[model samples]
Target: MITLSESGVIEKIEQCSNLDSIASLEFYSGILAPAMVNAHAHLELSHLGGVVPPQCGFSKFAQCISKSRNLFSEDECHNAMDFYDSKMWDDGICAVGDISNGSGSFETKRASKINYHTFLELFGLKSCDKTRLNKLSVVASELGLSNSLTAHSTYSLNCKDFDDIVQSNVEGILSIHFMESEGERVLYDGFGELHSWYVECGMHIDFDKYDSPVDRVISTIPSSRRVLLIHNTVLLESEINSLKGHFGDNLTFVLCPRSNLNITGEKPNFRLFSESGCRIALGTDSMASNSSLSLIEEMKEIEGVPLATQLKWATECGAEALGVGDQYGRIEIGRRCGLVLLESVDLIEMKLTSLTSCRRII
Candidate 1:
């Protein structure tokens, strides 16, 4: 059992019967582990929940979001943000690597108990004022939170915008939507639904200047640093090899399996990533594309993988990625890692069943 001071700071951890507590507590029969971390999320887009349909592909999903994103009032967005933030906390998530296009989440994060590292997102596909990034960066710094200026995705950033964001990403943590779709790379080759979608949307690009989407992005950023590559629904073995050559211990592939399924009806070739010995992590992209923001729901969508490995990805790897490695991710004493119960997960199959649910015990 864990002993928490009235102030919520961790006091001590000891065996249940041996521990003495002046306060009352609840107990349950389940496996206890460190609280989970969501490595990639979009709190700014929470207002767009269920505004887009599943299996429609990222291109169409982007189009629909573009059309309806601004329709919601600030109050509506704030409401969704509050609800989702509370939902993740109740689901045993202790930290999050959340993407924010504006300061919409700044106020909410200021009042939140969960550890948050806001990745101020810069998108070039449409347009973004590069100057605003420093302002947000300063604000995040003043608030005593970890923050990084990051890109929206491989496809959305043009050469100028990508370069600018890379220069500003000094904090070592770079979270990006890497190769979430083939269109990102295929648009360079001149034939794909994504290319067509881009043309129709008037976001045409000159792909002839670069080798491929992934290569172009890799070339622009730092070679040795923690780069949290998100989605990667179509990342290739060749690309993984290239990444390994440049980023040794600095690469982390943040998998959003359920969100990938919801948007594009596919998952990354996770076998290739695992076989390559790539550091893996888990995320709930957003409620905009996914039905649930539960990390357990994301794990349930993944099959043929060891549960322990994914659990490490969801907890340890995620904590490291968000710059909170010392504070959370393990059950060790003095870590302040909140305890959580994994209910009904089958150790034999290493698969999460419907009965499996995460309960916060601390």
Candidate 2:
């Protein structure tokens, strides 16, 4: 049996041999686990939940988000973020690495029960507003939230903007959308639908003499700080090797399979990631590309990974990547990491079935 203090910190853990005389002992039917950490999310876009169509491909999906994001009022967007913040709490997410383009979701996150590390994401084909990004980071800090100025994607940011973000990110985790679509590859090679779309929109992106996306990342981004590479949906074996060789254990590959499926009708090679000996974590990208911000639902999409390994990915790896391991990933003593009881699990096969659901227990 596990015991907790009134403030929710774990106190003691022991096997229950005889519990007839125990005082106020609570028994749960299903497996007990630590609350999960969402290593990547865009809480600022929660208002666009069902507005964007599913399986629309990355280029179309990007266009849809750009077009539909401003359709809602400020109040609607904040309310949606508030509602989803509570939903994620109810779904047993203890910590999150949330992305923000502005201060729209800041107040909600300031009042949230979940631990949030805000990533102020910047992106532009010509130049990005680093001053504005810094101002938002200051806003988050003033509200008593941890934050970092991050890049949106390898393909979105111009050379100067990308280099500025990397150089300015001295502390906290640096998150980037890495190789999530084929369009990203084509863009790097200076041709494809994404490239043509940029031209049609009256913009031409330059890769700044880089050989490949991975080369730009390796040559520019320093290995001194922690980095999270989100959405490796199109990562290749050679790219993985190069990244691991350069960043070593300081890099984490955060997978958002459900969101990938929703947008591109495809997913990363789970077996390849699992066998690559690289650090792996899990995330729910956003409601725009997913049905809900539920890690359980995300876990259901991981087909061949063992439930134990998936749990590690959802909890420990995520917490480590987000630098919140001391408080939110494990059930050890002294940690205030909340407990979650996963119900309807297929214990025999060590798998999470479609019926598996989770609730916060402590």
TM-score of each: 0.92, 0.97
lDDT of 2 at 13: 91
Tens-place lDDT per residue, model 1, 1-362, is 56676655467777666334645755565567789999998877888877898789878888888789889889999999898888888899999999887788888887887899988888866677878987988888888867888877767778888877776556547888888877777788887888897777788665347888767766787775668889888888888888878887788889998888888888988677777787888999988898878998888877666788778888998998787889899876567778788988776765678889997877
**Candidate topping lDDT:** 2
Give all candidates' CA lDDT scores. Answer: 0.82, 0.90
Give the range where candidate 1 is weakest over 10 consecutive residues by summed lDDT. Answer: 18-27
* Model 1 deviation from native, Cα RMSD in Å: 2.6
Per-residue lDDT of 149-187 in model 2, one digit per residue for the tens? 888888898888888888876776899999898888878
